[model samples]
Target: MHRLRCFALCATLLCPSPLLAATVFRCEDPGGHITFTLQGCSEAQDLQLHRAHNPTPGSGQPVPLAQTGKTTRTRSQAKPSAPLVVGEQGDGCGNRVTGSARRTAMIRQQVLAGMTRSDVESALGKPDKISTQNGRTRYHYRDREGSSRQISFDDAGCVKGKP
Candidate 1:
């Protein structure tokens, strides 16, 4: 029995046990580098581990998922989301949110055709680079991790990108 326990301990130390594993998003880049993280990745081949969890602590039962969307957001567990608003510097529009929170709220929105310049700015923060030529302009937005968006505008200061 003691030898069996020792062997089991050695085996565990060599190979990770799935029972203790947490769900993660795995991404394989084109350069053949693989990365694991808890956040979503947009520019790579991705694999997500679906984990079953107990709703209540000490309960062995797994929570049942609602079958309605790509991913379910349960109202019983969902927190209130902040609304996106834009105003002058002193109008209390950007005061309550952190820089990351601002980015989160903005990035979730799509830049639609015919959106005003100010509306685009409200949906997405300032552009990293701006270039204009022949009455068409492009605003480049780049996150620190190299994810980017290029928003083009027509001569009328309205978005030319798809909704």
Candidate 2:
């Protein structure tokens, strides 16, 4: 057992660890959301591969990967087939709301004050007509019954006071 242990130790000290190279994938969805992962992305997303190799031996430092060139593989070079749907409340909106609250508000189609332009656009789709007068912007929408609903935004791009 002692001789075997010595032999194993000698072998380990003599052998240099093999260099390993890992392939990393950077995926971007149609909405331009980026994510990096070892696993590849779906067919709908744009795929980019980044390869990094292990550092050389005896240097006591890891070598940085060279930025040779970038490779981007996309499913389709043309525009996406479907439109992107932005969430109602997230993405650093001033109106901070929980998931449930945002979902309920979206379902109810409620556009509250303090909500940004993007927030309103997310909750209710694009307006039928937009008009700007005296630094205030108004978004007009016509319902199925031909009833028109209007939302006004102040110069700051936030809904005024209350709905």
Candidate 3:
């Protein structure tokens, strides 16, 4: 019958097929940073592609892509800026020193990035540790050191005590 044939065709078209399903991929970098993207995983090195099922609407579930493949090229991105550094300009230490003494005595030491506490102490000397309760690192130094009568390094490792 014409009606039966039409019904059979509709059912065949509505059924799900593997060829029409989407694929999902998990990407990772050399540093172990992982990310999920919708693009195919052809060029992505160390990337894992997996076939996932599509989720229902408003089900709070993740829906997988329909294709799985590797990429041959990587997209370039911009790098972040370096950390900020604090300097000492004013204060009596600069004036007290003699003529050329000012330049030689008042030397500014910019702590290198990723330097540990021991490294800083070795470069500068034993700092007078100040008590802190609010999760902050504060070091105090008097006229014993170079210029800037008082010096303080904040939690971010910036000098703010005095210059």
Candidate 4:
């Protein structure tokens, strides 16, 4: 009788009003990348063990993964492109002619006030070199003809002086 009473008490303590457990899904891509999703677990090939819990109904909150902080590593197997080449003659507008005339033209057309360092570098390849002094950063770009242009930026990274 004592054992029966203890079992009944334990059953009552363990069983609660009906509450459904959350669904979990694991997925693998063609590239061998594995992703776990809670909303789409039926597609998982290897079903893991299940536990009983009262997950809030329709909360739509994502279950945080234990390995969420893992970073992916990638390898590149292609060679880098050669430096851009320019032509010898000058355009009628006084701009030196170059095979990269379109790119140079676009860079010259951009208004410097709102430009960022990355934008300048994208328009013009990495500067021949960079120098900083007195809160100013200077980017120098040298052409094949030995002519060089210096673009200066203020602390805020906006062009501050004439290029």
- Candidate 3 residue lDDT tens string, 30-61: 77777776684445447887776655667676
Question: Looking at model 4, which ten-residue stretch has the lowest summed lDDT?
Answer: 90-99
Best by lDDT: 2
Cand. 3 TM to true fold: 0.23
lDDT of 4: 0.64
The digit string of per-residue lDDT tens for model 2 on 12-110 reads: 999978757789899999999999899899999999999966655865775655857786767776667898777654444465555677677778889
> Please, what are the lDDT tens digits per residue for candidate 1 over residues 6-97?
99999989996445435677777777777777775666565655553335555566555765658678988687598657755531232344
**Candidate 4, residue 23: how far the Cα is off, in Å:** 26
lDDT of the candidates, in the order given: 0.69, 0.81, 0.54, 0.64
Sliding window of 10 residues with minimal summed lDDT for model 3: 90-99
Quote the lDDT for 41 in model 4: 34
Q: How many clashes show up per model? A: 0, 0, 16, 2
- State the lDDT at 64 in candidate 4: 57
Instruction: Tell me the lDDT of model 4 at 94.
Output: 33
Residues 1-163, model 4: lDDT tens digits: 9999999999999998666665555666555666666655345344443444565757777655475577665567444588556764543323323345545545674424445576577678788999999988999888999998888877777665454
lDDT for residue 7 in candidate 3, whole number 0-100: 100
Could you give me the TM-score of model 2 versus the true structure?
0.40
